[model samples]
Structure formats: C-alpha cells, structure tokens
Target: MTSTSTAPGAAAGPDAPRPAHRETLRTHHGDTVTDPFEWLRDKEDPQVIAHLEAENAYADARTAHLAGLREELVQEFVGHTQETDLSVPVRRGDWWYITRTTAGDDYPAFTRVAESPELPRGAGGVPAIEPGELLPGEQMLLDAQAAAKDAEFFSLGGLAPSPEHDLLAHAVDLAGDERFTIVVTDLTTGTVIDESVTGTGYGLAFSADQQWIFYARVDDAWRQHQIWRHRIGGDPSADELVLEEPDERFTVWFERSRDGKALVLQSSSTTTAEAWILDLADPTAAPRPAGGRRDGVDYTVEWAGDRLLVVHNDGVEGFALAEAPLDAADSSAWTPLLSAGEGERLLGVESFAGCVALELRAGGLAAVRVIPRRADGSLDVEAAWDVDHGGELDVVELDTNPAWDSPALRYQLTSLLTPATVAQVDVASGERTVLRLTPVPGYDPELYREQRLWATAEDGTAVPISLVARKDVPVDGTAPGYLYGYGSYEVSIDPSFVPTRLSLLDRGLVVAIAHVRGGGEMGRDWYEQGKILAKKNSFFDFVAAAAHLVDQGLVAPDRLSAEGRSAGGLLMGAVANLAPERFRAIIAGVPFVDALTTILDPSLPLTVGEWEEWGNPLESEEVYRYMKEYTPYANVRPVEYPAIFASTSLNDTRVFFVEPAKWVARLRETVTSDQAERPILFRCEMVAGHGGRSGRYRKWEQRADELAWLLDQLGATARV
Candidate 1:
C-alpha cells in the first residue's frame, strides 16, 4: 500500500516496475493459453503482495507531475459541492424521516421528528418538505457518520423502521463487502440493542405488528439466496428460515407488502424471474410463488387492495399489466389490467391509495404515468404516457412512497443537463409538486449542451450515445474527450446530471456515454443481442461509438480517453484490444478482464452465478471459445497499446482483484516497450473492495487522481 513518487516533472518520462513471469498454463477445450502473470492472483502470497505494491510504486512515479493538478481538481470539486446538506424529509406513519449530511463527514445522519402525525401537502403546488427546514423536537435515530467513525470501509446498507416506529433496524458493512450486520435499535430509549444478525445481506423488512423482521442471507458463493425471519427479541441462531433457494443463478430480493401483512420476495436472474409470498401473520408458513416461473419470462408482483397487481411479459413483447385474486397467485387466473402492446416498454408499477403509478419507456426515454383506480377496483390506462411526450434523454421513476394510503404518487425526474428533482404528481389532476433540486454552487445548466447521437455499428445497428459538453467548447475535433461505456448485465446508465463532470467540461474535455446493445437502454431485445454468443456485438458497438464521435468532429482520436468500471471495465479492456489506436488512454477500475479464466472455474466467487450472463464456459466448448476470443487477458497482443491505468481492490468479491492484477502484469510483459515513456500504471487498494475507497474524501481523492491522469494523457491544460 506504500509507494514512492518520482522526482518532480518526471511524469513525461517513465520508470515502471517490470514484474517477473511465472508461467501458468490454462488448458480447456483441448486448447492451451500460457498465462505468464497468473501467479500474481494469489493474494495471500507475499510475492504477489510485493508485485502489487511495486506496481503501486510505478503508478506513483508515472503520475508524479500531476500532483498539483490532482489537488486543484479536488479543491474545485469541493468548491462546487455543498458538503453540508439536507435531504427532503419523508413523512411516515408517526415520524418525519430526514437525512442530514455535515461538512467533512463521510456519511449522513438519519433523524426523525415525532411532532408530525398527519402529513401535510403544499398548498401552492410546491413540495411540502424543503431542504434545510427544521422540524421541532427532532430525535437522532441513526447517525451513520458517527456509526462509521471507527470503520475504514463503512456502508450504510438498509435503514428501516418498524411499523409502530419504536424499533429501528439498520445494516452496516465495514469490510467493503456487501455482507452486513443487522443492528436493531430501540428507538424508544435511543440506544442500540445487543441483538444483531451477522453475515446477512443488506435487506430488512418489519412485519405489520412489529413482531417479526425479514432479512436476506448470503450463501457461500456470495449470493443472497435465503430469506430468514427473526423475532424482535430472539437470538440470531434461532431465526426462522422462511425460504432457501437452491438455484445459484437467481438472487433474492426481500420486501414487505405495502400493508406489511405479508413478505414479498422476488428471485430473478438475467432473463427470467419469479416472486414468492409468505403471510407475515403466520410465521411458520411456506412461501408460494406468485406465478409460474418460465424461462425467458421476467415479472414482478405487488399487493393492492384485494388482488395482486402484476407486471409481466407472458403474452407481450415488451411487458403488460395484469391482476389476479389474492388466493389465486397464478397466471391462469390473472386478468389483463393493461393489455399487451409494443413500442412502449412497461418498466414497473407502484400502488397508492387512489392510483397505480406506471414507469414506462417509449423510444428509449422513461416517464411516469398515473393510472387512477376507479371505485369498481379497475385501472384507467387511457391516462398513460402516450398523451404527450418530449423524446429526450431523461429518467423518470417511482421514488420513495411508504404510505399505502397516500393520495399522491411520488417520483424523481432528471436529465443530462438537469439536476435530479423530486416531485409528487397529483393522481387526479396531474399537478406536479417539485420537492427538491440538487444544488451545484456557482454553476448554470444553460452553460452546457447535451444531445443524443446514434452511431452505426458494423452490422448496421444504431447504438445510442449521450454526450454533454460546455457550450463554449468548439465541436471542431480539437477538445479532449472522455468516453465511457458499460454494456453488460442489462444495466442501463440512464441520463442523469453529474456535477463532478464540470471539472472535465471546464477543462475542455467532452464527456460521453456509449449505450451499446448489452445495456437495457433500448429494451430487453437490446440486452439479448449483446450477450452469450452475440457478446461481440457489445465490443463492436463501443468501437463504432468512438469512431462516430471522431467523425462528428467532437474530439481527435489521439485526444480521447476511455474509462469504465467493473463490468464496464471489461468494456474498456475489450475496446483497448479491438481498437487501441482509437483512444489515447484507458482507465479501468476493478476490471473483469480475465473472464474466460474466472468462468472456467466454478469454485471462485460469483462464477457459478454468472453462467447465464456470460455463458457456462466449463460445459460448452462453443461458449468457451467465444469467451476466450474476446476475453481481455486472453487477447493481449504484441501491438502497441494505449497508456493504461488499471485499478483493483484486494477485497473485491464480484470481480476478483486477480483479474486486473494478472492483466496488468501480462500487459507490461507482452505489449511492446518501444513507447516506454507511455504510462501503463496499476493501482491496488489494499484495504478496499470492488467499490474502491469508502469515505467521500478518499473517493474524491481517487477521482481527482483519475482526472489528473486523464488530462495529462489528453494534453489538456489544467485550470490551475
């Protein structure tokens, strides 16, 4: 974890550590690939530790000239952000829940006020809760900053209150791993109870009467596959196991019904899903599936009034809405509430007292629609989002609506040039009430311009790209560009404002996101086209986006930098191998470069569960060959490469630190050293995990370092 920097102004010249080769042969499908740096995967070995530390030393030496720039970036970030801020208070049954952040603190403070019994709405069509407004007689419920004072890696996972508001159950993970410790606090006495469940997932739901709590537990392979229920005062070992899933692919998400009388859990994989319901009134009952689970079908269910409201794709191309009797939780007995359709994708649903909110995406843009419930217990779908629409890169989804009987539907909306704003829509009149807009000091949204562009892929597919830059920066291919992409797991990087990007924009760097086929940006079809045997589509799409940006005169090829993290890191690696000349530099954080090697072994963490997403390489020779062809570690060549900055954490559970460690080591040995002064830096966080450094200050420092490196590689002048 310790490293020495080179002399000042030495970044222009390189002095890097050359790791030794301990060749390891990996044979599969009657083929062998020699991995000379595979020995670096052994994290416990002192030799491996020394090599990682030496790489850290090399990175320190390589970026020595940017120390001043990094500091200046950090200071600029701090100036534009309000360190001390307050979130809009949400009112529950008997408490006004508020989250407050103090300057210089890594976490926020969760508090509550008891004076509010009946929630009040704004009269002039404004949000009732305003930022920084104080509620009388506030009580400190759980101060995360204070709780995380002693832990180096602290994650405030689940913060929930009992139905009666007397018991507060919160989970914390101190090791950067998602496995948390559920701690119960007696809110009546303002003290933490000794009862706690260790090694549990970050999910907690209290029963209607506050007698039982449902939480998820991670299996040996780090999958949350079990739901356990514990009595308020019972021992952790004596907790009841409500359900145990033997399937390794599906992960379980635990939740309580709006009425809090039943436990609702959804077990889902990448392409298929199923839901289970257990009446919390009877703690000894088994959970029953909401509907039959069919392969290639994904659906979720929720309780509203006397029936189960379902969002499924059984008969529709995109998805449809249906409802069934509470007892008959099967597809046959379900009646169509919103009929099947195309073009408009049914995202999700949330029920309130008077209406059901539908999150729908049309033409790849998201919006919230209100479907009011009639007196006869039916939904009005004519009021959907098809009425009027502005097809822009925007996000609209259901926000926190805890009260089952609330009259309004709360939602959050944001776009590329707009900060996030919380709003509540009146179900009847559709009047909007904006609660809060995130603050960015000394900044104006009008100063920037954002646009959505299409890039033509090799196969004639049009991939979407979201670009944002300062209006003053000329679009003449002379400005530096930062291109980002993550095309895996059907996870979409939606259009949202990022204040931190101002540092790059003001420095004349254009930021863009390549929404390739693997992401859910378009629809499920988009994801299917980029996974399994067709995974190469994602890599090719990214390459096309980079080329399109250059063709559009946005940035020169030699001035563009590409960056991605985790699975996105895999994207960066793939593109680096496919078209190294397109980018001047690449930043990979906790990258999954050794995909074929990891998937071939089932014993490693997350490998077995990832079979469906990346294909089971151990069983299928075709899958093995396909993965090996594009796997970054397997594809390193003798060609000249871009200046690379690879980072990984020792405790990363999802993407093991070994992947990046091995990739970096091999790149140093294989890639030609003719451009020796071109930096190929590796950074290892010894005490962190997949998410990198935990604290805000530490993460800011890391971001600044990355920006400094990026500016240096792009030949951009620092603001300082």
Candidate 2:
C-alpha cells in the first residue's frame, strides 16, 4: 500500500513491491479507524490477487538464495524420519484398523484385519505387534492417495464405519475450506452407494443399521449450528434437521453413543454447555436436552450401562465427576462421585464396559486415572506417573480408547526430547505395557536433553518454560535460540518430538516453549488469568521468558528468535510493538494481528462466538479503549522492527488472510528504512486454509522453507 511515514530511519525498502491502496474509514463506538490496505481483502478481485502475487514474487526474490538450503533441510528431515510407517492398530468392533504411510505416497492407506486372538505379552511386558507388515486377511478400508487423486488440496475428515462393519461413511475436503463432502460406500461390495453429500462438518456417525448418517452442518459463519440426519441411499436434499441451536455463539455436533443405541448432540460456547440425546431406535423422535443450560458452567456426558457419567465444573472451579440415571428427570439428581483437590483439574471422563477413565491435569502436568468400578470414588488415584527429568515426559494422556468392551486403556507419553510412546494398561490389574515406539532412523535421544524451567512474571506469577537442546550447547550466552509460545483458547502446546527440529538441535541451536498464563497447561485458573481483561498477561509472560533465557546465559540478545501461530501470532505482534528491541527475528503463521477491529464486528465468522474468550468491545467503551491500546495494527509506529515473516492462507476460515495481509502492508509502510535488509516478508498460499497445504510432502517442503529462513537470520548453519 502507498503510505508515507517520515520519522528518523523510517521508510519503505528500495525494492519492496508496494500494493495499490484505497482510503477507508471504520468507526466503532465513536472511534475512527483508518485502514488503507482494506482494498486487499477481496481475493476474487483481479487487482487484489495481483498484489498477493507481487508480494509472493518479492518474497521469492529475497529468499531465492536459500533454495539449496531449503532442499537440504527437506532431505535431512526425510532421512531422519521412517518413510514407510504403520500406525499402532486399534481394535474396533470385529477388526483391528491401521493406517500406513509409504515412502513416496502423498497420503496414508487405511486397512483393517479380521478379529484374531488377543495379543500375548512379549519379552518386555508389551503386546506383540508386527511393526512392518499386516497379518493375513487384511482388507483395504480407504486409500487416501486414491481419494485425493483429483484435487490440488485434499484433506480427509471423518472416517466412520457402521456398527455391523458393512458400510463406511467418509468425509473429504477437496478445497482448503473446512466444509466437507461425505461419501457413503458399501464395504462388502466395494462401491459408492450414491451421490456425495456436501457441506458437512467433520463429525459424522452412522446408525447401527448402516442406513442413515448423522452429521453437523456448518453455517455461513463457519459455525456448526444445525445437526442433520442423511439417509445413505436417499437424496441428501431430503435430509432431516434434527436440531437447530438458537444461540449463535454455541455450536452443535453429533456423535453416536458407545453402544450405538443413541446419537448425542453436544453444544457449547466459551463458557457454557448443553447436551441432547436422540434415540437411534426411533428416528422419528426429536432429541431432548440432557439438562438446562447453565451459564459459566461446562460439562459432558457419557453412557455406561444404564448410568450417565457426567463431568462438570458447576460447583468446583476445576471440575468434578458425577452420575445420573439414563432417564434422570432433574439436574439435581446428578450424584457427585468425586471432587478435585486444591490443584487438580478434572479434565474429562471416558466410559467403557469394565471401567471409566478420568483425564486430569495438575501443576502444569497431565495424567489419566483408570477406575475399575462405576466411578473412581475419590479424586485421587494411585495410578500417577513419577516424572523423570532426563529421559521421560511428564504428560501421560488417554489415547485411542475406542472400544466399549476393551479390557485395557491405551495411552501415550512424550516429551521435548523423546518421541511418542504408546502404552496399554489393564483396567483391573493396572499393569502397564509399552506397545510401540515411533522410529526416527538417524536421531539419538542421548545426544539431547530437555528440562522444565520457571520464569517470574511481573505480578510474581511463575510461568513454566520447556527447553530442549544438544548437550554440547553451553549456557554461555553465545548460542542462538528459538522461543515459541501460544497462550489462548486453553489450548496447551505440549511437548512432542518433531524430527525436523533435529536440524536446529544438531546445528547448535536451542529450542524453548513458554507455557504462559493463557494456556491450559497449569489448570482452568491459569487459562482464566490469561484471557478477557487479563489477556495481556500472555504477552508480558512471553517477554519475561525471553528475558529469563538471556539472564540464564542461554542465548545472546541478538541471537534470540521467536515464533507463534494464530492467536500466538497476536502475541508476537503485540510484544513486537511493546518491546521491539528484545527479539532479533519473528515468524508469525496465520496471525490474528487485527484483534480490536475483528472483535468489534459481530458479523465476522468467529467474532460473536469468541466474545466469551475475548470480551465484546463494541458494546463496552472501556473494552474498546483497552483493546485499542494493545491492538497491533492500531499501534503501528515508526521504529526499527525485528526481521519479520508472516504467512497466511487464502481460504483460512479461522483467522482471515486479510488480517496478516493488512499487517505486513502496515509494517512495510511504517517500519524504519535502515532495517530494509531485515526483510518483512509475507507469503500467502493461494489454494489453502488454516491447516495449510494438505499433502505430507508439500508440508515438509513448506516447513523446510520456513526453517531455512529463520536459520539464515540466526546466523546458524545447518550441520547436516
């Protein structure tokens, strides 16, 4: 965009491609906001599309020299990874389903084997699994490579099999848009049943009879407001609407009950929740609400035999476990089974034939409690893991507990330095078995180390930080480091090994994660303290983390880089405005930098739904003022910024591409001219959305480009 700011050392780059600008004014609550780059909002406009193409050309010219390095990074990552890999099989109904990714295929192949004898214990007290090959009578369920053959961008959504195992209803997203088309097939005959049903959400379930499908239908705002029932062989236009949520902020989705006897419609917003149950035996009846909606309280329901297991945060700040008769007439009948302790947060509960499992988090760690009876009876269970600092991860989660009659619960454990390990535990005996360990061909865990560190926030609050590095990288303030953070939506960024990260570790660089207030790592309280009016705690905590690393002599002032995606990108932009000199470079992927403007507009996709997480500024003048004070685009000034790279997807329905497009435009117009060599690069994927390109190989190349760019800025050469 063509705009001028003539403060000391502030002007556009000599070769920067400037997009044409048109003046636009927006007013909210008597406040005037000017946006010159608003013309770039419409992707369909020829001029708007040309500007993005020009921006891409400029970015290509700048990073063209790193082409060789990008290829090398891609090769190094591929070498470390097990090209031909098989996922740990899960028992479902009468078969054990598995997915495999070959060396050159863009997608995985889903297959299943006939029910066999129970796996016997091996030498190491683990279930025996043939890691490389399938057993006899293996049948192909769905080949993703074949499904994606016709589309430039293909993403698989729901893949649900009928209770009788004769029909499969799978969802496919051919465009980067989140909406999917579900195709029903007769598994026995291996043929498509009829025309595909389009505009369906990811959550789709089949009736036990295998004649109908229940799915969530997304509205124009990308919200799942209606749940529909579609007949497999009938016209999708004749699909019945089972429920329509009146509250726009709340979304509705359906899932078949454990016994496949009913369909559950779960609806929730940022702070409240409600559930409805539909009897599958009588498809003509409407679903009835489980209980009256309670404000500021959230809960979920699961059926075990004739009892309804409920996990709610009604009376307890964290959460508590309760139960009711399947046909309970009143909410008061919810019998409190267990209450969380001072620091424990009862996350959720999973029901099975023999036992019920509880997922809990405390002191920034995660664990799962397996109760043999109908309930655990108490909040505390003896099935806790003692975390090992050097070798093991602190988080142990309940993973793949699919069968209603399973005798064992499958869980996973991982850390910053360790690859994921899938384990199984007997419900009755509580004896744990290690099932599989993902193989990374050329990497050694012993050569690297990971640790949890704490940093003090301004209010004396301690923030958790996860760090990993090569043993040779000394804390002498000479090595380069990359710090990452995402503290919104109560979404915890836990530690999981990434093979691509080896390129940084072997190159003598340190990687760290700042577990700040907005994340659910600690508990509900931690998340509460970081959102709404307390949202700034996230950005401040991140700054404190960077300062803590420097004070600990782990990285130099000029060698430290930063990264954040989505809301974390909002954090990156805010901190950059608040303290620009603290970081040397930053990469924000699909960032939400235009926070204040987005929140004030109610018609946008997620604005109204997100008002609970981020308060509505349009109705409150105080909130509008506060949001204005910290909003990144609103606070752009003439200053020397860190080397910046912002990425966006044209079809990203979550955070619109216009946000980052406007942000990079403003930065190029306002930032110091002396920093011209420090590129403020912007890259937009013309045919992708929030998750980016679909294929694994495409994703790897994209990652290589990003890592190479950051590595070049850090002055750290890749050793491999």
- Misplaced by over 4 Å in model 2 are 1-14, 117-134, 374-392
lDDT tens readout by residue for model 2, 94-164: 77788888888889988887666655445233334564576567888899998888677999888888888
Q: After superposition, how far is residue 148 of candidate 1 from its true place, in Å?
A: 0.8
C-alpha TM-scores of all predictions: 0.95, 0.94
Put down candidate 1 lDDT per residue, 89-154, tens digits, no spaces. Answer: 776886678888777888888887764444455642322554455555778898888888877888
Instruction: State candidate 2's TM-score.
Output: 0.94
RMSD of 2: 4.5
State in Å the error of residue 630, model 2: 1.5
Model 2 global lDDT (CA atoms, 0 to 1)? 0.81
Note the Cα lDDT for every prediction shown: 0.80, 0.81
Q: List CA RMSD, all candidates.
A: 3.2, 4.5
Residue 193's lDDT within candidate 2 is 90
* lDDT (Cα) of model 1: 0.80
